[model samples]
Target: MKHALNNPYITRNFNPNNWMSDIPIIDSLSLAELVLPGAHNAGVDKKASYTALGISHWAACQNNSFYYQLTHGARALDLRLEYAVGGDGVGTFWFQHNGFRSSRSLESLIMSVIRFLDENPDEFIILDFHQLNPGNQRFDYKEFNRLLLTHLGNRLIPSTHVFLTLGQLKQASHARRVMVAAENHTELDSTYFCEYIEHEWSGIGTASVSELNVHITKVMKFPPGGSLPWSLSATSYNVAEGPVNIREHLDRWFDPALSDWVLNSNIINADFFETSNLVRHCRTANLIKANNH
Candidate 1:
């Protein structure tokens, strides 16, 4: 019951979906203290139809679905929303990457997050809405607000509650477990959602594994300080690179860094998260930190 069939990518015999809930010690850690695995471009996945679009190789960062990412232990999701015209002549939000809108709607992905949270109540998640691009000059903030309030309701932790430990947040919400971080917002109130938490990236824009490794080393030596939580984007972008090629390089860098590099950041965001043992390492880190405390 704790595992799925053996897979070459995902680690076997672990409860990723309920990881936070399963580890009681994790509840004592604040969002700023715990190390978590995050999915970069969390909603972009490869399907046969998307592959036919010819951009799948470059566009897709994930080989699995959004729900699969959550189930596999991605606690933070980097989501970009695009307002696109649907077949019915109405505009709706879709998960987007590099100007390519996905076939999946943003609402569907949110619902899947809700479903996962409901099933595993103690597990918490951070939804980082980093960008909201509109197709036209005017975008409907009202509709977007309605979508969030209608679907997420009270499950969203208020922006003011960012400082709370997971146990404190759970008690504050009577057990609600999600924080919606929308950086650009007009109508949505801060009481229900927060701005995008700060994050740091290589700034090299496109980097090879060696370059990224150097960047991380420099940052950790002089990491920024603040009460707010931040993430380290452990990713490199290259249009010529596909998931497999990028992962092959990342695997070489990640395994060694898990024990040391992970200790420096609250969250470690990556592309193709399932292909590594990040979940296990993160859990181990949390346990050690808690025990030491």
Candidate 2:
């Protein structure tokens, strides 16, 4: 009598502990070849008193803390910040979503990430510091670099060389690597602060998911190897709608079209990533690509 073959999908239970651990097959592939799940406005998890009504419409993009975001398989983080200075000449940083200030400080967020990376050695992260809100004074890129280095320490992957693959990063002396990309630090010597890879972000003007789908579809079409390592914003925000609940929107529309978006973009970023199992979808896309290769 012939015995039945075992199916890995049936035998291996889907582990929620770390979705990144599930995609070991793509470890040897270039970062450009993998599809990473990302969070848009990753820092704004809470609302502040000074947060304006219009800004509040899209303010709390994420509902959980930074640590939670990592655990849920978000590899890329979009951070917008403003330099905060005390009367004593000491300076700190605060997260900004549009013009509204986040209740949590930037240092707090960085510390949380450092602690997470220390525990999870095999995992790597991409930190995109995009927007800066300088009130009256000029934004200090040098000071920001100092703070980033102090917190990140040796965990940062030097911009001097490109990290081609996940396995390359895992085998390095410092297993936990973070690629930092900032908008202001343009000079080549600023290794820790580099520019972002191509990212196509759709405007948050669509009031309904149907309207938003059109924008998403248009952005997904790209020439072969056009925008390798590119990010696509899959979430939607309408200032006129007032306080758009991300969780509700994801369940209603984004979740349905997620698989197609994942196939098209290297990074598919959304609001409240944990809600609709967006990370798992991205992982599946990577798995499919690896199998085909």
Candidate 3:
């Protein structure tokens, strides 16, 4: 059976090269008013770790590089960082998912985002550092923050100003600004670290499509007049029978779920983000909101 996500029109209309071109006024909308396409485990690729069960079961969430994800209209990134130890007793930062190391280092991922922002100055991104995993070694939060500031430089949007609308953000600065949310790092300056953003739900661990849909709809309910920006995750975390084929799960649920909840969602994060019309859908939702106002 063919999946809705396989439609040729989706590919043609939402091509990465010009995805943002359609939404010229996107920067002017409030963050909550815009429905941003997000990537879950945004850094995970073919290089992620797996159990003896093989890569099929523990396959990575994303197929393309970070550069590709950004160019394709993924504005929000779910990042997990860890301290990696080498044989020389030296530790470096790495991107990890469930303790599995990604092929790309943390430094490389940050550089990719920096490069993207350098080229596309009008586009802004929400970088959610959702987790910091320390594997067998003690992790230094301060050091990690230092590394982030060193690479990101002046591109970061001051934390105090992140709650504003896209237009307000653009008006505030000429350089592109990225909203950085370092989870559990409340001690950092408010100008760079925002602790109020909420992740409504994550990881629907089911293989049954019907059951998954039920769970997705149930968690998607958000209260009216909420202040913080929240995300509704449309990706599955585990499959009961085999390796996690997130693409298959997305093909089955992405369209239906978006139809039901896109209007209310702040961000719709999924796996294999480039394979579907997620960007178009988000833009449409934003347009609908704009019209209602």
lDDT of each: 0.73, 0.65, 0.67
Return the top candidate by lDDT: 1
* TM-score against native, each model: 0.88, 0.83, 0.83
What lDDT does model 2 reach? 0.65
Question: Which candidate achieves the best TM-score against the true structure?
Answer: 1
The sequence of per-residue lDDT tens digits that candidate 3 reaches over residues 1-293 is 12243333434545454444455655556666677889888867654444334553464777777888898888888887788678898778777777776666777878888788777777778888788789667776777788778878588887777778777787888774688787766445566877745676534454344655676767756433354567776766555432244555454444433354666677777777777767766665565555555
Candidate 1: where is the Cα deviation over 4 Å? 1-13, 48-52, 243-259
Q: What is the lDDT, from 0 to 100, of the residue 257 in candidate 1?
A: 34
* Number of backbone clashes in candidate 1: 0
Clashes of each: 0, 0, 2
Q: Between candidates 1 and 2, which one is better according to TM-score? A: 1
Off by over 4 Å in 3: 1-18, 47-53, 202-204, 223-225, 237-260
TM-score (C-alpha, index-matched) for candidate 1: 0.88
User: Which of candidates 1 and 3 reaches a greater TM-score?
Assistant: 1
Lowest summed lDDT across 10 adjacent residues in model 1 is found at 1-10
Write candidate 1's Cα lDDT for 212-259 as tens digits: 878888888877656566878788777476543355544444342333
In model 2, what is the error at residue 151, expressed in angstroms? 2.3
Top-down lDDT ranking? 1, 3, 2
